[model samples]
Target: MNKINELSYNIKIRNTLYFEAAIGLSGNSFLLLFQVFKFIRGQRPRLTDPPIILLALIHLLMLLVMSLVASDIFMPGKRWSDSTCKFVMFLYRFFRSLSLCATSLLSILQAITLSPRNSCLAKFKHKSPYHMLGCLLFLSIFYSSISSPLIKYIAAIPNLTSPGFIYITQSCCLVPISYSVWNTFYTLFTLRDVIFVGLMAISSAYMVTFLYRHKKQSQFLHSTNRSLKSSPEHRATQSILCLMSFFVVMYTLDSVISYLRNPSNDPIFYFIVILVGHSYASVSPFLVLSTEKHVIHILKCYGRTVDI
Candidate 1:
């Protein structure tokens, strides 16, 4: 009786929490898509920092797909075929690594974009956008391929839960991956996350510090005029901070929680952690839309048309 109650509780946690989070993720991801379209299709269709929002929307779509796979995996007696399991695991790892790399790219690009004259990144400021796009594509596809081996962790199990429902319960969950491989995964991925997080932190700090100093230097030019000057760059810095807060900080927590979870011992925290992992996709778009005036203008235009 106690075991059944516990299992039921775990199932409820998986379903309810995941459903709620999924709803938010699905809605916000579509909102981002709509906003992006509005900006691109509006009268003056010049996107500001196109790469950042583009990558974010891609990450959001991937998150929505991953959430659905997670829903399947959490089913108590469900069993997956070898190929099905492999694909799901592969996509999950691939998308996550892609998100991390995209975020790091956003930070580094912003750093280069905002660097002052004679700064170290100034030389690369005029780097070809075509080359940058190629590199990002390679990173998202080729670099992320390294996680393909993780599919070995997934295995199929029989439906021993209920004799009556044997026909319906078709798939199984991942057995605890081997301790050595699992630990190695944790160590290696943790190092990867740390490296990217550090890069983003340093880049964001440099941008914000440069902008603040630039504002202060304005005061020196005219001693009697002490007001801080506002610039588009200042707004860019704020947007970058908002984007980083969502991607870097929330991502670190999600990664740590995912690494430490013991699915057999506790399924609740796993669901909760997974929820946090996807929330970045759902919430980050609001930041992007709010920070970019053009997108809001388009939204307002659309709203007015609707009102009429």
Candidate 2:
């Protein structure tokens, strides 16, 4: 009885954390999409513009879908039927696969951006923006295709034997890790991706620091000249660096929590993991919008106009 009670408490904590994370991520994604849309409309839409924007939009949608699933599966007195639960479970798996693909592409882009001019990826940098756009699209499609098959095992079914908990109502149906080898492979793959992401983050930070120093030196040298200012590349680099930094920080925390979790069962840990994961998507948009000087200026101007 004590063990059961402890489990119940853990499960409740886990669900609450997951719900909060989902809500936060959803909010961030929404804000990112809005900022992207506004930027595209207000400025010229480039070849590289669509995929990240689309990804953000898709992620936002998935967050909403997941929220509905969570409510139906986890919330008491509002549980979904088997069929509905199953559908939501499938959708969550499908979207999660796509999200991973999208994130992978984003990481690759960051790596390419930082690669040396002599590197193979440098060739892509010189390609027309349209070509870069095509590359991103192609890469996204290939990654998504590779991951699609993995979603089939996911299901949303009630835990008839254990009546009280929510996550049990519907959970991802992963293929049984029948062998230690498979588990090892899975761990390696996850580690590889994390390493790649870490490299990208490091490169981004290096570039930002380099740019900052360069800017300072240039300003000092040209102190007397009023005409010389930071270039567009500097501005764009700053923005991208800021975005990457935010993603890296949030994702690192999420990954750490997930890594610490026991796969067998630990609801409180699961809840915290979910909360962190979801919070990123929702908060990202606001971060982008708030950080952009032009957007802030526009908002201030609008306020003044309204006052007038």
Candidate 3:
């Protein structure tokens, strides 16, 4: 108890955290609906479609995760009970992992969708949705539940701590587990990142290669004025590229911070980590939605009908 008290430090909750969370939640939730609309109103309705469905699920999970973390920030006080702290930590970790997995899976699916007939990834396109959904379910259950029992954390219990510990009591923290059991949780998370991030990087590069090889042929076959950018597939590929770019940047920054993370480290570092981590979720929908030409078509139709 004394050692735990010595390690705990007071964390100050700032107003910016709440503001970012609120705006992100509102924007993502609304655009998530628009994503669904895009799917439902498509020329061909696909109830079992993996690409559209997985994308929506990713945004939905991102929104839910932002809600959980933000709601905790806005609580009346920094102090939380054992169960509450554990719950917060669990939801945060589990959902964040799922979001990354889904995003990586999305890039792979996009590449497969755009692949040539003979490409290896093309065969898996039809089955990707089921596999992605199943993986999401498995990760959610495994991450959320498995860590609860082994959870080791320190809460700021000012009233219960020794007098010497009274000065710095502020918030609860989910402490790291020992190396003896690291293989079960930490190792899995590391491998997951290595695999998914590698897949996303490789697949994205493959897409670029495919596009480059096809571009000249496409231009020669079509009109000189025909732009590859006019295609829906091209637009989607660009948007997904932007999303992954943002994710990579943030993930890199967060990794650096984690390497430097320590009990005596500045709270601002943690704040920066949280802010950058959520930026992808907050801004990705708008970035992706902007690429959809259907919105423009619908608006033009409405204007013409009104004018008539």
Candidate 4:
């Protein structure tokens, strides 16, 4: 009975992962293809469009890699070889880092776009694409240089029933490292997360301030008018703010759960952590697309054509 229950639980987890991956892949793919079509058609892209494209692509790849990892983690019987485990995990980590950097850049880009002409951030408006590219390059280098230890430490579990192996997944485990080494890597990873999250928070605050000042100014100018609709830039900023807020919440929850987890190697705990960690990648495209009028317009046109 116990064995049967465990099998059922694993099956449920696997199904949940499959569902999440499918939804994320479809959303991200649609967003990506739409943006690509815009570029191909020589349409003028918004300042935030490039980052959105990059972000969609990043999340798409991350979800794909995550789906692969989930297959190894939940499927029983055949185990991933050592090389397969290392490669898949390394890809996941690489894309994960890119996601963080891209999100931070997205928020900052939105803030720059919404800045008043005389504001300090206005100067960055024209140079945002270059800056974003440079930042992503730097971040990729940083991840390769600082987080490369993960490649060394991650290995396929030689024996599933071994007593000394640390549980990462059913097939992969982290080999033991010295306390000093572990502390060094832990601190570096934590610091990286802190820096990106801090950037996001700062950018979000700036956007909020701009929106508040704009609202007050508009109110004073058009006294007693209650129907002043927000501008496109304002709507975009709000969307990015919402996305950043959700990302921070998910990040904090995942971090806290990881920090507080016991060594009992609970499968449920692992699934929760994974779900929290992947939530942003799986959900962000919809958050972004919700504010994109272009996608809606295109869909409407397509529907009309279909009905004809």
Best by TM-score: 4
Off by over 4 Å in 2: 1-42, 46-48, 76-90, 93-133, 141-153, 156-176, 181-185, 195-199, 202-206, 224-232, 263-267, 302-308
Error of 2 at 24 (Å): 5.4
lDDT (10s digit) by residue, model 3, range 1-308 = 86454234322344565567666666667665766675677755322245445555565566566555544443335566766655656666666766776777678777877887787766865563566677656645654455455445434344554532211114444454456665666566566577768988998898888778778777778755246778878777887888788889888887776656555434455557677777776776676667778766876899999999
Which candidate, 2 or 4, would have the higher TM-score against the true structure?
4
The pairs that clash in candidate 1 are 78-171, 78-172, 79-171, 79-172, 80-171, 80-172
* Residue 105 lDDT (model 1): 75
**Selected candidate, larger TM-score, 1 vs 2:** 1
Off by over 4 Å in 3: 1-13, 45-78, 127-132, 138-171, 175-188, 219-222, 225-227, 265-267, 296-308
- Candidate 2: lDDT of 126? 58
Higher-ranked by TM-score: 2 or 3: 3
Residues 86-121 of candidate 1: C-alpha lDDT, one tens digit per residue: 676667677777777777777778777778788887
Instruction: Assess each prediction's global lDDT (C-alpha) against the native.
Output: 0.64, 0.57, 0.63, 0.82
Lowest-scoring 10 consecutive residues by lDDT in candidate 3?
Answer: 163-172
lDDT (Cα, tens digit) per residue for candidate 2, span 9-97: 65676467565656557555655656566676787543334545655776676777756645443343454554565566566655654
Best by lDDT: 4
Q: After superposition, how far is residue 158 of candidate 1 from its true place, in Å?
A: 4.1
Can you rank all candidates by lDDT, best first?
Answer: 4, 1, 3, 2
The digit string of per-residue lDDT tens for model 4 on 1-308 reads 99899888888997898789889999999889888888899977777887789889889888888877776667656887888778888888899888888898889888888887998888877774645777777876775667877788888888645665577777888887788988988899888888888989999999898777878987888753243243677778878999999999988898899889765667677778778889999999999888777776877999999999
Question: How far out, in Å, is residue 141 in model 1?
Answer: 4.7
